[model samples]
Target: MAGALRAMAGPSAQPPSAIRHPPSAIYNSSRPMQLGTYRLIDRLGTGGMGEVWRAEDTKLLRQCAIKILPANLAADPEWKERFLREARSIASVTHPNIATIYNIEQDGDTLFMAMELVEGEPLTKLIERGPMIPLDAVRVATHVADGLAEAHRKGIAHRDIKPDNIIVSTRYVKVLDFGIAKQIGGTTDANLTQGNMVIGTPHYMSPEQAMGRSVDSRTDMFSLGVVLYEMLSGRKPFTGNAVTETLLNIVMHEPVDIAKAAAGITPALADVVRRCMKKQPDQRYADCDELRTALVKSLKEDPKLARQSRIPTIAVREARRLEPEPPPRSAVSSHPAPQPTPAPAPPARGTRAHRALVADDDPATRYILGSILQRYHIEYDEADNGADAVKLLKNREYSLIFVDLLMPRVDGWGVIDYVRGHRGNVAPRVFVVTGVQNQKLSAADQDVVTALLYKPLDIAKVEQLVQKSA
Candidate 1:
């Protein structure tokens, strides 16, 4: 896998100077494990599916990644066929953004696959810090959509399109892992397990996929929408505590408004995500080509993005535009100007009973609540997490509070504990606002909150809550 990944780093299949090399321990210098014309040098990773190794093609004088079926599972005929299916899927398509399969070989009873080495981190790693710049996110999505367009044209539907399966190479955005790819309108790969169960990653599964129904190219589009949403918002659109709950969310719920969830994103770009995630496959773009076109148009319309038909090496860090130099130290003014007086504080909160606090890690949720609070002429304070909400509680007493159940540092439950712990004659009304469903709130949970409001919060209900509290 390391060799294949390295080849993907650039045209030369070498890691860029900026990328750090793996630990020396990752490479085995003992004795080269030879198979056919390839010498395995490094163990990249291992999973339930297969074990990947970085190998040198002695005959071709090139490097690639070899995926070996685990010895334990090699005897299973179904697993063996599925392993071969992955190779066929990759070999069937040839595109700049799609990883290539060079060969599939066997040594005695052991079978392995040699594929193009991609020397870049997965998209999942890139998004770990936070949401990406909107333009860059759009660029990556557009490139991925373009790749899927080609695969779709060849009648292959990549059922799995999560960020982990997409590599952000120095020269291109390459989609990897076609293990679950299904041939459209084919009977062999029906997207089901032995017991009529669905075969797809839970978080990104489309409605049809969640239901274990027949899927087409539209399924890929839905998964892509989930990825794009995560790229823009730094979070998944559908989530729950358990697998069944998550599947339920995917099948039954609408996600928070993207325009509201991700700040500084255009409504047009959000609309593309919206349409792609429609529950019905027929309601989505007719094909990936249409989806790619929409994303490209969005890129062209974004004034901040450089006008280009093709995306540059996305794995490369964005060059920060240097700030303009401050007017060369003015020789005439040796001393700094005196600071201005601070503005007066607002009216005392003790006299007003309509003050509120909105605490949620998501900027979009805060934005929505803040806007709603303003409509009712109620002053409010915003906290990005629970700890900050606690700090705000100490200074002022708000009549109402809207808090998300999950947050960084201290979660929403902690905020409720602080509120309930420091009980006063005039207790503040705490509302649990979140995307997570808790239809049967425990007695303790119900005691702390006045109400449990689900996400995509109803504007009318919010307004009513504010008006009544005020």
Candidate 2:
């Protein structure tokens, strides 16, 4: 029974010596190929599992990025199957924003995948250079979302979405590395050990993924949320001293307030991230389409806020977070830039404690926002919709107000317009947070809103905005 299971689960056998390795440990070295129909021109890089080489396909006479499994691992039946599965799944996805898989072949014992050679820097490199401009982040994230949407449509979950998996070329953003992806209907019980092995890079795994739960397309959305958060703020939403601790936090802890993580980042951008990081899969945006819609709306409502809100410290920290930490035995030394920690502020006074009113039709969004406010010990009130929100504003005063753009009976924009038209002088620091797409606030509406916080609000960012206004 065990042998039958093994055979059924394992990929077709190939010769072990066929697995290819770079000539030297150093990356980007030029070498000639010893096997296959391709000639290796230069080494691209190596990862934990394999080496990627820039090679010429002699038959096709075209350049390709050939990813090869290490020789030792190639003999392992299960690993080979998993690798082939990943390559085939990635090849099935066809999107402009996703890296294309050209072919998959097993030469002897070595499994190789030839994919579109993207001439560009990884998102990690860009983050290392500095915080991405908000507009640039939005643009890149939109493209990523588009790619994810396509993948999700095909019932494939990326499983690993991190800065390292994203490539930014001059004209396009490509999402790569689908080595851990699984089809929706694939057996969850297949290779239980490998499935539970925590197959993703730390710092970017969603709570569900970290906890070893069966993942769906929503998992990719959460990963994208982390990526988007890092792109805009320049730091990951969660961090810790060790991999286990980091994964534990992802599964259990709420992320640091975005505003606290990076001061001056727009609340709207923070909200988008918060929604993406929703712990429960159902709580996140239904898919990448929803996320893309929210990002596009943010770009339209406050292009400047999106453009100028990038915090450099966040990016530097992200670069440090994504790169593999040096082994203790390594002779070389590299020092990451110092990260500035946000000082804890004194508690707010009774009755006057930085007050906020959250208006949203979605119970989950409101609940999450309320939780964030509670964590910061801020006094806040909730309104089910725009009408209640407007009524609450008239009856009492708040230091800040978070208005959801899409709500029944007078939406966020309507409430803002009403408040400005009638109680212009009494308007508090109004922030419109919404998931609505292609929303453009009129000049009059803009005058009344101090800021626009996008939906799926990041709690840390909300706290920062409240403190800034306070």
Which candidate ranks first by lDDT, i.e. highest?
1
lDDT per residue as tens, model 1, 1-470: 32322222222211111112233312235433997899998888754346688999999999999987754455777666767888898899999789899999987666889999988888999778677666667767977988999999999999889998888843468998887788999988565353233456778888877766788999999999999999887889998765566677888889998876676566678889999999998899999888877876664443233222123223212221221222444468443211211223243235535588999975545766776565455688999889999999998888888998788889988998899888566667789887655556678768778987775455446655665565
Model 2 spans with C-alpha error above 4 angstroms: 1-34, 188-196, 306-470
Which regions in candidate 1 have their CA more than 4 angstroms from the true location?
Answer: 1-32, 194-197, 305-470
lDDT of 2 by residue, 80-181 (tens): 766787787887889978889988877776678888898888999877766665656777788888999999899888877898889986445799877778
Backbone clash total, candidate 1: 9
What is the TM-score of each predicted model, taking all chains together?
Answer: 0.59, 0.59
When summed lDDT is taken over every stretch of 10 residues in candidate 1, the lowest stretch is: 12-21
Global lDDT scores for all candidate models: 0.73, 0.68
